[model samples]
Target: MPCPDGNAGSAGASPRKEPITVTRITDAALEVVATEGYDALTIRRVAAVLDTGPSSLYAHIVNKDDIDDLLVGRLSAEIVLPEPDPAEWRGQLLDVFSQIRDQYLKYPGVSRAALAMVPTNLEALRVREGLFAIALAGGIEPRTAAWALDAISLYVSAYALEQSLVLQRREHPDQEWVVSREELMRRYTADSFPQTRRYAAELTSGTGPDRFAFTLALILDNLCPSA
Candidate 1:
């Protein structure tokens, strides 16, 4: 994308000298997302960000879905895969997934793209391979490890989508739909929600990351009971 400063060298920007590559396309696309939010991330918008036409992008990115794959691939580069340590596999997995979650949060609704991504992209594969190896180190069977990866990816994407929606709603100046913990606790006292009343504090307890980690632990711990 055209750097805000008009210098060729900047975050998610292309130099006049550099030929447009997939890297350039991905960078421009991210710039569009960062400035206008993910909903505004279209091939046409990315083209505008790069100071080019949509026609120029197609030679590099086949379609919208292809660009989505590239965007996930770009984000995957930021994931720091831990060296597979059998003893710390669960912790390692948590770190990787949390990194992905954070990256998705950065671009707001981009996690929705993540949900539709095929695993064939090489950058995405790198993460998948690293995660698979980690699960193997924890002594999970290959089939189980593979299936768990799908589940973990799905959950992370969904979680990030929810968070993005919350942020969007907050920007609207009408946050009444988001119940406060105290209000939720009080409401749970209704006779119809006896169990909720009894466990209100527990239900309203954890912050987002707390629940994120707790959920990851639930999946990872069972993968290797001894790990």
Candidate 2:
């Protein structure tokens, strides 16, 4: 089957041959992860989607984490990194982080998949490589650059996971019903926590993009002394 445009299976396609086979299992994996989150992902569920036995899925993936890793790998492939420019290294970092946040939100359960993923695979390694190049261009030490990349990725993933949980709770009202008791908690905080109430607008302001921009600015400002 020909891979759809702008999707993973599109890689390595050519007019001369049939598009690489995209198993129903692969499509189902994405669906399961997106809809149910990583904890709920299972070989049996994927097999059910493909109308195959769990035994069959075992041939392709060792377990749920294997499939989850594949999902993150697919995500990495979709991200486009910029060529390092010394003059614009900071902007490039912001773009990369923004793209990561956008992609994770788009996929819903991606934050869970990212939790244990290391940059060992080709796609992930490429991102690390790109970050290293940018960091070098900006005069950062190699060790600092590597650790900083890991730190930034962890920060972004944590934020994405928090956002995903909120969205999931909202979408699944049954889950939200239990969580709905927390409205009083917010009120309580607003009353008892002076800072929370005083700057509630600042607290809620531009949560995604604005916060990202602010974070990037703060980091860049600190790094300016080094630059």
Candidate 3:
């Protein structure tokens, strides 16, 4: 798909088929994602976007994994990690997680590269170091801090992927698949699900941000002393 005139960050019609550089390759990959979605990302796809061939991409990046690392590294550079504040560690973390989520949602499905992978790039490691420093400052033990950060990162990545899929489904708008609020309530009949029926309205009340914050709060509550 040809991105509109100003959406340079999205999929292009292979318009930037110019000289190959690591930076250009990264941008082309993201544009491919923005235009064709993340599932369509590949060595050939990115090379096509860059107006080059797959072998040319391999000269700079080892493979698709390298591209994933580069993409995460680029995004890590964009996230402004706050100075470690002992008293406000929870809030600080909330801000960081929110920032990460927003960035991942921008590219869609890119967070999959981060799951179960070591920080392959300096920028990505910087985020981990920043999170560890903040958590440690808040009195969390070293080992706990490491595991907590990993858990939170996992959830954040999973959440981004799920959200991206939901967005794609919403774009197509299939009524057969989507359960409307009304439809959901009707399914929660008292006989089959009494307690769920009682809290049907409450279950569906929160907006996406509200639910995101609630989950983050649950995870962050016990980490810091003051919470």
Candidate 4:
């Protein structure tokens, strides 16, 4: 009689291939963060998205910190660093920082993960090198250049994370702002908040990009006074 299970007995049958990999896991984790915010990102959640058990993820990633590191490293690699121009150092720095900020924004909550991280990853180190080169070429002292890079990086990451939070809030109507701008203005007028009412237009003067440019200019001016 023929074998009861045809495929089970067949020598020509193809073996199942393993689907798990570091890149696939990282991509799934980023998707979770992009769609549901950072707070929703967890090893279990990532595993679920991959249709695998949480235990399977442990073979690749050590912990949540490992995942965060990978996410930061992956995103940092996307930054396109400009060649340092001594005569155009300020503009170069501005362009580089803007690229970093835009990349973080693309990944939503990933910037929050980068806040406390040092540039241990190769890609992150490359970004640091570019910033330092620009500052140094512009005649900034070494120590001052280091400190300025730190401050600028923190500012960009914090700004991106804050914007991500605002976007998340906007996605959920139930968590909308408690006070509308019109209502806040009315309250300010009623309460006789003289300064707020007097300069309301100036206070809300710039769009997001405008405010970002103004703030970047302010930091660069103070950090590279001689430039």
Candidate topping TM-score? 4
The predicted structure with the larger TM-score, 1 or 3, is 3
**Model 2 poorest ten-residue lDDT run:** 14-23
Error of 1 at 173 (Å): 1.4
Worst 10 residues of 4 by lDDT: 178-187
TM-scores for every candidate against the unseen true structure = 0.86, 0.76, 0.87, 0.88
> lDDT per residue, candidate 3, 75-94, as tens digits?
89998999999889989999
lDDT of 3: 0.85
Model 4, backbone clash pairs (residues 3+ apart or across chains), number: 0
CA lDDT, candidate 2, residue 17 = 30
Residue 15 of model 3: what lDDT?
52
- For 37-154, candidate 2 gives per-residue lDDT tens digits of 7567788887777766788777666777777767777777878999899889988988887888888887666777777676455777787788778877888867777777777788
lDDT of candidate 1 over 56-120, digit per residue (tens): 88888888998889889999989898899988888899989999999999998898888956766
Total colliding residue pairs, candidate 3: 0
Model 1 per-residue lDDT at 159? 95
Number of clashing residue pairs in every model?
0, 0, 0, 0
Candidate 1 wrongly placed segments (more than 4 Å): 1-19, 174-176, 225-227
Cα deviation of 78 in candidate 2 (Å)?
A: 0.8
The per-model lDDT (C-alpha) reads 0.86, 0.72, 0.85, 0.83
Cand. 4 Cα-lDDT: 0.83
lDDT of 1 at 109: 87
